[model samples]
Target: MSSPNGASEKQSEQSEAISSRKWFARGARAAISIPAFILTAAFVGYAGLARETGLTLLETLAMTGFIWALPSVVVLTGALSSGMGIVPAGIAVALASVRLMPMTMALMPIIKVQGKTKNWQLLIASHFVAVTAWVYAMKHLPELPREARLPFFVGFGSSISTFVFVLTGIAYLLVERLPDVVAGALFLLTPVYFLCSLWGAARLNADKAAMVAGLVLGPVFFISLPGLDLLWTGLMGGTLAYLATRIWRRGLS
Candidate 1:
């Protein structure tokens, strides 16, 4: 049998554990609404748009859960629907995915455990760093404790993903039931959400400049090339913005 002191210590540990769980749950819930409203609009559009592309609900869900990047999903579905060959279509998807690299780099560091978290864990964690998650995490994670950040993010992001996943399916199913104009309006939500969020969240001159360049060039490229516009727009716009920012910083130095 344990001593009185040992029994009291065990009770204290249990109480502490319960309190930690409550604290973490509260933090996670706080993070949820950060992206919920914006992504609800965007993914509703994506779902309707995906249905138009003739992608099955399973395919839509797979893209949302596995790829988790809206722009890449748009590129892949468009290329596939256009009857592009698999290799070329894949290349286009890969090109669209390139933009996610910067988002990942900017976000994963916030929740990483350095030596404690393995490289593969970090790689898997990086997949969840999409535009919605990245923007919300960057905006809100600072208010959370270091230890609670990852769990809070996992809870918050998983809820958002699940919500969007279900909404996408529902929107896809409802697209036909709704009138044409309403469906079309739904399809436009993602870009509008992205435009507003990027501008609202941009903290640097370079970030604002890049977003403005993308905003201007995106329409031109879409008009010029139709379905393949996202690939070229991302590559060219991102490259130009990065180079221009680096040059400006160097000149300042």
Candidate 2:
């Protein structure tokens, strides 16, 4: 009979294999699910809003393709509508995208592919790097092997991009018929989805602490400081959470 340790090792190996397969499967499904459709709808709304607000179609598509961020696109559109200068619009967009920096830092270590392959992966990833894909990858990629991680992310990202392209076209064409109430409701999904997913991903102690801190601090900061609220809230909440976790761990050790 196998030793208990050997049996445990075998089980762990099997579990890892199963998890890898599941990640791959999830990558494929995410590329073609209701969630994907919802994400695509959000992008489509961005394009339609841009057109209605007098931005060119090329500019709209360029933002979707390059920025790949909804909040930034919305800020840009709103700024343009308000007769803001291109420089200020661009600054607002960049500020909104700063949230992705932390997300990328957390994800890179998990999905670090090397060599020419990594170069290609990065090229494809830039176009697909939106909120949904980021959330999905952060939650699932840790269980995946380094070799499989790139393919899984590429698949997931590509799927979202493809859907977004189609949805953007649809939104551009149907902008007139869509009611403002419906459009506003659809727009709410982006933030709701991100917040809910972020909360759900807080399985670790550090994540839970950071999330709780952010939730508590975000609104309070917003009330006190309107323009710089998100930046300050994230910094304070994340820093406090990190310090608290460190102290707790030190005490335990």
Candidate 3:
């Protein structure tokens, strides 16, 4: 009947299909979680802030839809209103997004999605890109089958985008009705949720090292260089963490 090779090929294809389905399932779970809910609240706060700061609703929505990066949007909007040149505002936006490069590198291996197909997925995925989704993917993808990674990412990304779209619209309309305290509390959700997620996800020596380095360096760098604080803190702290890990591993060996 069937040759062994043919049977093996069929089995491999089936395995891949199964893996893809599992990835999507995991992503669906994350999409409906507390963290995702917090992200939506934070987006609402961002929309309110944009309106309060005199940005047009259309501009705010455009930023949410296209930029999809909160910190960058904040910096760009603030810089523009402060009379900064367009070039400087653009640079500020780019600098704020530098963290994504490291995030992308960390996720590339876990995703294991390859070639031209992956390119298109990446383009679509970038629209919903944010710190939360990246952290979730990094934490969960390694434990999943290879074929599922893309689907999982798609699910999580789509969830975040959908929530941002609706919540942002709501925030724009309701900003005036919401109390200042409530708006401030909503704005705090993103950072708090991110720190909690980071703590929960820090399973390895490298993660611990990085966290410690960031804790020590972030405040110091922030006081010294307000505008470039994140960039400098991340670079210096991450490098120190890497060096420390290497030294400790060598000593153990």
Candidate 4:
């Protein structure tokens, strides 16, 4: 017969696994209910953007799976097609993903599956840490048990990521068939939703400041700097905003 403590430990493990499954199932339901497809519409624009920048449908679809972030995909694809070499293109893509740094930091703690996931698995899961999944996870993960959060997020993210990858190919194929006006409208939807999500989720004074600076300086920098505008706009504008908010907070304190 098994020792009493051995049986108890096994029982506990089984209970945790069962609970994790329940949470994972809950996450799937939530993913369906939230209608994650609407957000992936941005990838449709991404597909169109990639094609306009000279990527074939297959290459664009590969990007949707590998790059996995819309802004990064757009930035890198645009640069590559413009004849920018791999080094410069890589730098530009990295700069565009600077925002994801903080998001991943906040999300990792909530979604980390300690003792269960390998390091490579965590790294792969981190790639799925984009705006839509982050927002949905942040809003819903708290309601779940610690054992379940990671599984739930993995399930939820896997579902949406797969959908996005598939649809990007479809969009590339269909963009040429759609009316020009409809195509243009579809392309704008992602950015519009991005801006709204940023505003809604911003909690810090610095975040608001960055947005203000980006809007104010983005066009000005574009006119002045030409090809390097986005990079400069982010560096100068984000830096100034950070400085301003730090100073303001210190003064108040």
Best by lDDT: 3
RMSD of each: 4.8, 7.4, 3.4, 3.8
Identify the runs in model 3 with alpha carbons over 4 angstroms from their true place: 1-26, 114-117
lDDT of each: 0.75, 0.75, 0.79, 0.77
Give me the candidate number with maximum TM-score. 3
Q: Who is ahead in TM-score, 1 or 4? A: 4
**Pairs clashing within candidate 3:** none
Off by over 4 Å in 4: 1-4, 33-35, 113-121, 202-253
**Ten-residue region with minimum lDDT total, candidate 2:** 113-122
Clashing residue pairs, backbone N/CA/C < 3 A, model 1: none
**Total backbone collisions for each predicted model:** 0, 0, 0, 0
Q: Give the CA lDDT, 0 to 100, for residue 112 in model 4.
A: 72
lDDT of 3 by residue, 140-245 (tens): 7778666667788987788677777788888898776467898879877877888889877777787888988888888998899976888888889988888889
> Candidate 3, 236: how far from true, in Å?
1.3
lDDT of 4 by residue, 146-175 (tens): 777887887788778877787778788877
